[model samples]
Target: MKNILYTVLLVIGFSAAGTAQEINWVSLEEAVKLQKKNPKKIMMDVYTNWCGPCKMLDRNTFQNKDVAEYVNKHYYAVKFNAEGNEKINFNGREFANKGYNPANANRRNSVHDLAHYFSVRSYPTIVFLGDDSSLLAPVVGYQTPQQLELYLKLFKNNGHTVFKTQQDFQVYAEAFKPEFTN
Candidate 1:
């Protein structure tokens, strides 16, 4: 009976480990430094603490196994709080949320300079950047795993280069068949 219990516990542990989906998230500075060594596209999750859709995105989209695997393989993911008080230095410029009030934590605070630079007006914006730290595009709003797969493949495969016109992008979107389960 002791051996049976031990075996069951071991199986449970392994199952938990297997089910864990981890996205390889790094700081913007770390991503920039690492790009010098091995360049890859950057995917930034710009979210605010007070946003409900942002929380839903974290709980649903980012937690998806297929999304985690694809993002980890192709891009250096960065989670940036638009209302947080962290300073960021990118492209020889400094960025910070000057109006971040600790007294009003988790409420609608001031936006970060970086968020302004990216022209992020929404809470859950996914900013895509080139390997050289240039802005590719900004996808604003909460996206499901399957919904995000379109943009992921579009940028990853450099489809943006050819699909310059709105019509071209529309055609591509129409043809895209998402492979992600969730």
Candidate 2:
């Protein structure tokens, strides 16, 4: 009887340990507010549900323990659905679903004005913003967990502003060491 009780307790403990709470995602407004307080940059994952690579990024890259820990530590991470219905206000402008197609099930709501404002041309685009919510350039295409780590560390350490070109970044990337740990 004692052995059975011990086994049950162990199972409960393991289950609790395995279930990690999802990352605490901040809304654009909340992020801006937090930026005023803490002065950290913003990392926005702009994704669409219909995009396979976006799903893969969420599953394989963002969900990785190292990636999550690094992002959570360095930046105010935000998951913004490029096709979602949430209203967003930025820089005295209101962005919403202005071009939604009701007939096409796969057609998502119109790209939010904020997405257009950032000039995002693809799904799963990762936009890194300055502490003042200014554009720091959007990185297109899918990135692996390690690849994203390089960018996170660079931007967090102010390397992006220091390097002038992709070649310069490559030089930095080659010698890059991640300052944040999992």
Best by lDDT: 1
Put down candidate 2 lDDT per residue, 1-182, tens digits, no spaces: 99999999999999986874345689988998999999989999998768899989987788777787777777898888887777898888889867756554355657767788889889989999988888887989898877888888778887788877889988988887664333
Name the top TM-score candidate.
1
Q: Candidate 2: where are CA atoms >4 Å away? A: 1-21, 102-109, 177-182
Count of steric clashes across candidates, in order: 0, 0
List TM-score per model, in order: 0.91, 0.83
Model 1: how far residue 171 lies from native, Å: 0.5
Candidate 1, residue 45: the lDDT equals 98
Model 1 lDDT per residue over 1-182, tens place: 99999999999999987896889899999999988999999999999888999999998999899999999999999999998899999999999988788976789888889999999999899999999999999999999999999999999998999976899999999999999986
95 in model 1: Cα distance from truth in Å?
0.8
Cα shift from native, residue 28, model 2 (Å): 1.0
Which residue pairs in model 2 clash with each other?
none
Pairs in clash, predicted candidate 1 = none
